[model samples]
Target: MNTAAPALEMTGLTKSFGTMRALDEVDLVVEAGTVHCVLGENGAGKSTLCHVVGGSLVPDEGGLRLYGSPYAPRRPADALAAGIAMVHQHFSLVPTLTVGENLRLLRLKNLPRRVARVRDEYGLDLDLGARVSELPVGVRQRAEIVKALLREPRLLVLDEPTGVLGPAETDALLATCRRIADSGHAVVLVTHKLGEVARAGDAATVLRGGRVSGGGPLAELPPERLVPLMIGRPADSLDAGLAGTIGLAADEGVRETGGEAPEAGASGGRREASGPAPRALRLRDVSVRRPDGTTALDGVCLDVGHGEIVGIAGVEGNGQSELMALLGGSLAPAAGRVELGGRNVTRAAPRERSRAGLGVVPEDRLHEGCVPPLRVADNLFLGRLERFRRYGVLLDRRAMDRAAESVLTEHGIRAGGPGALMSSLSGGNQQKVVLARELALDPLICLAAAQPTRGLDIGAVGAVHSRIRGAAASGTGVLVVSSELSELLVLCDRITVAYRGKLLGPVDPAEPDARERIGALMLGAHAPDSGAESAVRTAAES
Candidate 1:
């Protein structure tokens, strides 16, 4: 072992919120020139640890040492001064500002020269003149990383950095992490995916229920040994084949095809030979234009059958967002029709669509899905206040609380109670709450979920998959949009690729080269066959 002093050391770290203790007697160490991974389920104190290190939160009790010197930071600026930088899961950039302008806000000098130098050095290709709000989530992630790298800190903390990235972008970020470590700095990667640990982690620390469960060099501890520590169970006990879906079997050289789609009669399975399955959602020659009058989706045609789950796969900014928005009734199509449950909902409001048995789990849960400042019960019953109205004007708070309590228990959401603020729950639990609310609609005819499992741990991913499958089993047509192809391959019955603005292929996941075919389609490598396009349009119209 090298005898040099470690880059960072924490002893007996603890943090609490009201009656809840987020972190308890935690200890950690990071050696320079190595990538250290922090692994845990959501609410397992990982984000709290990152916040404490980044100076967003101060530990109630702890002692920290930086290169053998006592260190403490009261704010993010102080942490930056001490050579610490953090890239958050949610970006910190001003949405209206350009990348260069955001950098200028950091008070950096030599704007043009330094921005270009850092961008080149870190292989971060960002459009410095582009407004953050106009960029895709993937591009926003790159901007955040670039901002962190520009500081040239001695230690870097990245929290769920790959949650919004595509496969190529994820690979690039891992390579960049390796480069940073090789440059004699310490890097902390907070993530839920085990494949990433195998790919980039030099060492790891596992947290369970806010305490260190197990940790060691990656070489010494394989994924099998780490799985139980992270989720309190053997790898084989994961929900069906989810061990491979979330990469828990990655270190064992498990192939991507190990997790197959559910068998017949299971989720994503076809209905028994009862003629043709009823159509739950259909889009005929649908077209949508952005505010700037640019086409976002052009002449898209699709159909989702009841008891069927269809997936949409593509690189970010390929009209997936617009498609979801159009379905959710937030954006109107320039031409064509959207039918839910065989009724035209072309100009319906979100509430009208909801009443028509449509449920939506939006991609950006924090912003579009729920209100953080409200109580969990209020958020759970949002937009459906009439159901609990006592006198047509007064909300029946007791009834709402009772219903929320049952949902919390049924969904296994960890929160203080229905009265707790939505902001206090962890990301995974927040997502679960959103899902439970949407799925609770008695006659939910169709469900549209976007990036449903992003940033979730192995256990949470399995739970989410099970819930979505349950929805499909109950005869709800499901549409999922995700960047993770592995997830789509396992969860979807038919997969479609979005390129430019057109929809291509209802490829069967059971196809031998399904992943390869979908990848090629995503890149627009070959023009879609005319026959296939005709067949899709026929299915939608029929």
Candidate 2:
């Protein structure tokens, strides 16, 4: 090891919030010109550690040395001046400003020239003139990375950077990490994806319950060795054989490849249907248009039978958002019918749809899923406060709190209490709260979840998958829209590719060539009925 004074070193670092110790006597070291991955489940103190390093949260104990020099930052600006930059899990860009304008906030001269140079150098293509709010999550993430890179810091910290990215985008980001490391910079990559660690990490540190559990170089510590440290149990103990069945282990090659080859009856080992189940949701010739009159979804015909999990897969900005909005009752279709439990509810209001047994987990949980300023209990009953009403006027706060407490415990959510602010919880716990609230709706006809596991840890992923599968087993049709193809492959019985606002084949995940076919279809290739099948066959032969 060519170790010439480590890039960063910490000893006895500790941080706490209220009575909770978010970080406890944590010790970490990062050598220059290397990529170090920080692995942990949500609430495992990964974000807290990052905050401490990035100068967001001051550690209550211990000290840090940067390049063998005393390094203590009072604020993010101080950290930036000291050659440290951080890209947060949630974006930090001003939503109303254009990308170019946001870059200007960094005090760079000749904004267009600098942006173009960095964009070309890092392969981060962003529309500088576009408003931050108008961009999709993936694009916005790219913008954040670009902004961080423009700072040209000696140390860079990225938290859950690939959580919202597609497979291709994820690959590109990994490459960028490698490039940065090769240029003699140090990178701290905080992620839950074992595949990413295997691909990009040189060394790693695993944290459990605010303390260092285990860590080493990636070569010596593979994913198998890290799993137990992360969740305090072997991978096999996860619900539904999640770790093995879903291919979360790096050795399974599922991460490198999109997913595992299909097994017999590959509905993720779910029970086979005895007969034709009643339809839970149906979209017949459904079409939607953007406010500017462009087609967002065109003639999309789809069906989700009771007790089935259907997945929608595509690159972002390819109609997935519009489809979710249509199903969630936030957007009206320009044409066609939307049927839920065999009842047409295309024109129904959002609350009406919810009352009719439709549960929606929106993509942006922070903004759309819950009210941050509200208590966890209040958020749990949001949009359905009438359920907790006493008589027809006064709110029954006690009943709401009790029910919320039960839901939190049942869903395995860790929070201060029912009275805790929703904003105070970690990304994973917040998602669990949303899931608990939506899934708790009895007589639920259909559940629509968009990017349900985004920014969540492996443990949380297994829990979300178990919940979805359980919902399907209970005769609730589940529609999962995700940018992660591997996630869809492992979770859905049927997968459809969306391209240019059009729906393609609902291919079986059990098929041998399913992954290849899905990839082809996502790139606008024709389905099997068209001439594209022969093209794929020929390409394989060659």
Candidate 3:
């Protein structure tokens, strides 16, 4: 048997975009039988490196060795034809089509027909006819995997694979990735989760500022050591609030200069929460039906207290998005009461909701949070533009700049100019703009969806978390729905577990039955029979 070269190899790779030097002379080696992790912060050239490998971009300069031979892919098709499949953070599956149909559209010969029989063979809960849009986030991710595997690639590159997935979903996906590696296909796992490095990775390469910061066996260094190398500095220990915000330490830092000073974690010491609490939000027996007529939320209920943070934790796709929309006032409940700050506003418009002291950080921030073409200051006050208008006459640039500058100072959001287009920012800074706009509303309640900090570095993560906790401490009710358990554990005073559209129960973080019980409830290991609905009722009363 021929002792072949590694499945994929790249040496002295470099690339730049305008003044932004995205990638600098980076090297990588991937063996066929092991999972290789590419680590870095957002804008750290991880994506640039992948684009170079996948033929999405012709490198300004670099060389590639594929399957032991010099190879240069002229285009994405060239890479695909050579058996290199890339799955990005965003799913490529067609939302309007069923999983089965989307798979067929890839034209992998008989792959579509074969999907029906052994769809679960890859370890994801998937249905053949389920449309990608109708399917939950986890299942949609599975469709992406199925699409890539259909081509039977010798090498697979997954960018930010676990960014959308919850803990359970991530663990299951990692196992499937390992199986693929064992089958002699090299897999490149790109992620911000340091835990994933220790758990699923066979080998890891850390990239910082467009350069390889470090590389070794996954077991060689602990998280502390690995973090500094990735960011070119020692990781700072933020207060508890900041840690949870930035998707843990891995994403807590890495903010661009002129960006908002990220919020720090709330003081770890618990405060005695009190009342006569100004009302923030209220929901009663909310039920939502899917387009396929399936029930996503069944007679569910919830409430957010002013100046408080109520965190919702659940497995991925357990009515969390539905809950967020219902609160954001985008989707109406089939039967329920919706109230905003002591006002019954079930039938109110989204604009009305915002007018009534409600602000939201959308799950898909790129689309829902900011307008791509809008200026940074304009985006920051997009929802509250009325603040700039006087007598319904003209646009006020000075007032807008003043508002943006205030948010920048308080929240430390960075941007080149108030007139800089929203799309010009890196992800973390863009998120800061979103937060600045919403928080500046001084709303009674803030409904934050998934709030994608998963791929950010540690300092950024800490800032976001700290802001939420700070809001709560200051008495702005926050309804934070996240698939991240660590976030719930650290930032929330009380956490409620939602599973498959049912509330297991709301438990105090200080209670003896906190972590283990919450985890068990999340997995449906054991859920208390009563009081789940009561949490919602209590919110209404509050």
Candidate 4:
């Protein structure tokens, strides 16, 4: 432990947004050449504390010292100048600029060489000439990390860095973190995953209800103790939604598909009942081409039966986004067709698809799900605004407010009220708003949710999963596309793998080797024939 002085220290930090106390009398300490993990559930003041430290938001009260000197950065530039860099959970790159161009904008001397050096050192492979918007979500996330590392800050802060990474990428990034710490840099990792905390951290701090509840060396406070502190409850007390995440047996309410393992690649092996369930959605030979002329989805075919939840598992860039776009009707397929409720919707517009009872919870919630500037009431009634029309023109404000109030309560969203601005809510609450609105529509045929709980806490993840399963129980087919294999196993009736624009296996999660089989499919290790072969392999090892 090279602790001449603490690299960063905060004392009694407090931040308030109107009536909400985001961080209350919080304290944190990070030592040089060590990884300090901040563990917290959503709204536990983790991001707020980070923002105050990074100078993006000024704290209303409290004090901070950098390397034993009084420090208060008036702006992000000041923090940067003080050798502190933060990689936010969200990317902050210009969509129009290329990766290299974005790096050069930092005005760091010898930009190309610095980026090249950092990329090579950290095992980051990015196309410098590719525009930010042209890259897949995963690659863009990598670009963000590379951009931050280019600063070579003494104190590095990363918020949920592995949330979007695949297994290999996550392992590589963790290894890089170790190297960064060994080289005398202090790393502050803000995450909700306990596994990461156990594996990567030297010291850990647990936050609950905007206060520091417990913290100590990783060895002194293992995950078994840390989880309860973060959640403010015993791990065993957790419901079905979160228990399975940490390898604990799920609670009784959590549905588990049971039977002898389904035959791999066999549609017959789906955990759903064997009788002919009506098809809710279908895609036939769907192909998509990116604007940069790459084949994003190559002749993909899929289907989801009513009363079923189909999980799509793959590395982030493997046609998931393209598939989502096709389902949402945001992008037209270059070939093939899409059908919803047996109606050809291949050429339907987004609004038309929604009209046909196709609900979508897009991955990029900040931009696609709801308008942040709008009031909660307006956002809740966004797409269905027509229903509040009294005379086909005059709006019914009172009706909308009442409806919004009902949704807020029914969805269990913790916010001021319907009058509150959507931007004022935390990330998890924002997702609840999206889910409430989408599910309230009673989507008859299909619900396409991509990374529905990307940045939510365990409680929020549980809520989202329960709601999705409830919808399936009501006979609505759901397509859950996520990078988390564990999540797929928890929620889907039949888990499938997508690889390099191709669809493979409808593996039953009941299979003993489901996780390993999914991992193999994601890495393209198994080559079940594209069409019929994918349809009939037994879930058991063949």
Candidate 5:
């Protein structure tokens, strides 16, 4: 045994914001040439720990060491100079620059050769000339990873790196992580997904409520042990068969992996298709053209019935963005029609759409859903402020605050009252705020939610699912657009898969092969290959 100090180590690290503590006496150690997985639910101090190590935030207590020496970094530059590189879950690329230009900013000589080597080694196919703004979300995420790897740091930290990747991309990235670790570099992966941990981790550290619940060799602690550590309860307690499946154990008594999808619906189980329900939302031959003159969505036709939940599932950037924009009324269709509750709303403005009982939770919550600079109270009543007018001219501030307070409480939002800034809330809490506002509208027709639970923890995700289901139960049609297959499998009565600007299948949820069928459709397997496989792979790796 080497018996040397760890590549990196933290002892008694504690951090706080206001009265709440984000981290408390947290400790972690990473060995060289090893992949260490940090497991935790949201707000469990996982990101905070990464931020401290990456020099984005300073801890109020405790200390850190690198290679047996005290290490304290004041900023990202300091950490980078100390041979540490971190790829955040949210991309940090300059939107205006090309991929080639972004790599050049790292100030490394032989950049092209390095990039080419990484692409070959990591199974990535990125277009250097593509503008960051022009690329899809998955492509931009790949660019971020490439940028970080260009540094060739001794210590690499990836915060939820696979969140944006498809299954193939995720496997490739995990293989790349192993290769990096084999070369004697330390790797720290912060993630909530148990499958990834089981597949790639050499060591594991589980965090719950800002403290370490368990830490040991990955093989020693299976998902059964890790799940209880993460949520303070057994996996079966949370959901049926979650523990065994998560652990990849031999005994999967409840559901088969890659087997038939369950034959059930939301909370109340499967509902018989009552013939010919009223259409809550309808799109006929809808098409969207991007500024670059590319057809984002082409001749797409879909509809949702009143009192039903329909899920849209596909790999990221498979016309999902275009579909969302069209549904939200932010983009006018180039051809065909959009109808909300049997009325033609093809050219209706966003405000008009909202007024006609359309509620939307956009994919990008930070930029589109809520204003960071505004207080929670103001943001809650953002688009529908006219209702608060008292004398037809004067605004009623008190009424707004009162309404905000009630919604906040009803949504179980934990904040510094309604006066708290939207920027100050955590990602999960920010999502709750968005949900509170949109759902409170009590829309008559349909509620379209795009990536509603993208970055939430298990607990927060459960809450969001319940609210969406509640809307459907209340006779409001619900359309959920998500990249998380598990979420779609659980939440939707029917699932639709999109590929290459084409929509397929309101596949019956009761069908045993629902997931398999949808996955095939998502990859455009039913029709003769339109080269979408190659394009989607390129999108995944870019």
Candidate 6:
């Protein structure tokens, strides 16, 4: 019997622009029928390397050998022809299209009806007739898989596959990848979350500052070890802010391997003002109905105290987006009163909400958080453009530049300048920009929706957590809505598991039961004997 050569080999790969080197002599080896996880921070040459493999970006130097042959794909189709398929962190599926239609989008010759049968066999549970826009985030991702499988590739590259998935969805997606690997194919997983790399990977490659830092099988290094190797240096400390709030003790279990985890949520800060009032965000029977007569937020009633960080965790469709919109001031509450900072603001415009001491880090930052076309400094100061003004009728560029520089340095943002276009920054940097801008407002109440989603490495995530915790500590009410249970467990003081559309109450997150129970809840299962409802009921009604 003859053994086959490695499925793919890349050596001394390099790419540069002017004085900056995007990829500097990078090397990667992926074996057939095995999973190789590549770990890196944002802008650590992961995307550039993948672009070279996918034939989107040409490498400046070095070579690639696919199956012992020189590999150069001029177009994405060229890579597709060579049996290489890529699933990106962000997918491109028509919201209006169906599963079967999406699968048949690439292959006009293939029968749509025939491919729909294959989708079911995989237990992907995609309703071919259902619209992609109407489906959940997980279902949309599944459609991307079906789109890739239609090409039937020999090698699969998944970039941050679980970035947007919840606990349950992430497990399911990892199972899909393993099944594909079992069928005599190669898998390359790119991610910054060390947990995912440690859990799902068979072999590991660490990339830091645009270079390969280490290599070997997964067993050779634990997630803890692989992290520092990928980051080149130990990430900065957790800043003490998150540790106090998230229950981080001296032991620090699940040690970080890559970037430092952001500080935990604003844990201990100013005490809540005491009075007849509960010092909480009170919404009385808030109802939001769409133009089409579809009710998104039902008569929801809830309160978040002045010095507390309240987190709402749920699957994608479970009114998380709608609730965020209501709180953030993007959509007005159709009925009932909204109160914050001892004032009514339900009928107020978004700008009015911002003026009423309300800060927001929206879910879709690219669309609403920051304008991509604007410069980083301009966007950073967009909220407080007036603050930079020295005169009654002037825009202060110098003051704004100084503030922008301070934010970049304080938050560890890597960018060319405050004048640098926001579009040029990496995803994590963009998120940092958003956080810096919102926190600068110093609002009394903050509503964050998936603030740290795409492009964040584990280290940066820790920093974001610390800041959020700081705000709550400073006596600013905070409400966070996210799909990742692990994130809520780490950053939230009290977690409310939202299923379908109903709001579950604030439950304390602890070990042992959290991972398993949260996973089950995300899948729409009744919580274990010790569940969200029971946990909420037993808590001293504070």
RMSD of each: 3.0, 4.9, 5.0, 4.0, 5.2, 4.9
Candidate 6 has its poorest 10 consecutive residues by lDDT at: 530-539
Q: Which candidate number maximizes TM-score? A: 1
The parts of candidate 3 lying over 4 Å away from their true place are 1-3, 116-118, 235-278, 373-378, 386-430, 525-542
Per-residue error (Å), model 5, residue 292 = 1.6
Ranking by lDDT: 1, 2, 4, 5, 3, 6
- Segments in model 4 whose C-alpha atoms lie over 4 Å from true places: 1-3, 239-241, 246-278, 528-542
Highest lDDT scorer = 1
Q: Which 10-residue window in model 2 sums to the lowest lDDT? A: 531-540
Runs off by more than 4 Å, candidate 2: 1-3, 236-241, 244-278, 527-542
Q: What lDDT score is found at residue 304 in candidate 1? A: 82
Sequence-dependent TM-score of model 1: 0.93
Q: Once model 3 is optimally superposed onto the true structure by TM-score, how far is the C-alpha of residue 29 displaced, in angstroms?
A: 2.3
Using all chains and alpha carbons, the TM-scores for the candidates as numbered come to 0.93, 0.90, 0.86, 0.91, 0.89, 0.84
**Better by TM-score, candidate 6 or 5:** 5
TM-score sort, best first: 1, 4, 2, 5, 3, 6
Task: State each candidate's clash count.
Answer: 0, 0, 31, 9, 0, 19
Model 4, range 1-542, lDDT digits (tens) per residue?
A: 23588989999999988888889998889888899999788778888888888899999999998878888988998899888889887689998999888988999888878887877898888889999887777788899889889898888898878877877888778887888889888899987777677678899988888999999899898555776787666664564435555333433223333422223212323445243443688787788898888888877778787777888988888888888878888888999888888889999998888888899888777667889999999888877998899989988989998988888888778777888899877777788898788887745578899888777777777777778877887778888988777777767778778887887887878778888888888888776645434432223322
* lDDT by residue for model 3 (37-146), tens: 99876667887788788898888887998878888987999999888999876567778888778777877667745564335666565677787776656567667877
**Candidate scoring better on TM-score of 1 and 6:** 1
Query: How well does candidate 1 score on lDDT at residue 41?
Result: 86
| CA RMSD (A), model 5 | 5.2
**Model 6 spans with C-alpha error above 4 angstroms:** 1-3, 94-104, 108-122, 127-139, 232-265, 268-275, 278-280, 289-295, 389-398, 451-454, 510-542
Which is the winner by TM-score between candidate 1 and candidate 2? 1
Off by over 4 Å in 1: 1-3, 250-268, 271-278, 528-542
User: What C-alpha lDDT do the candidate models reach, one value each?
Assistant: 0.82, 0.81, 0.71, 0.79, 0.77, 0.68
Better of 2 and 3 by TM-score: 2
Number of the candidate with higher TM-score, 3 or 4: 4
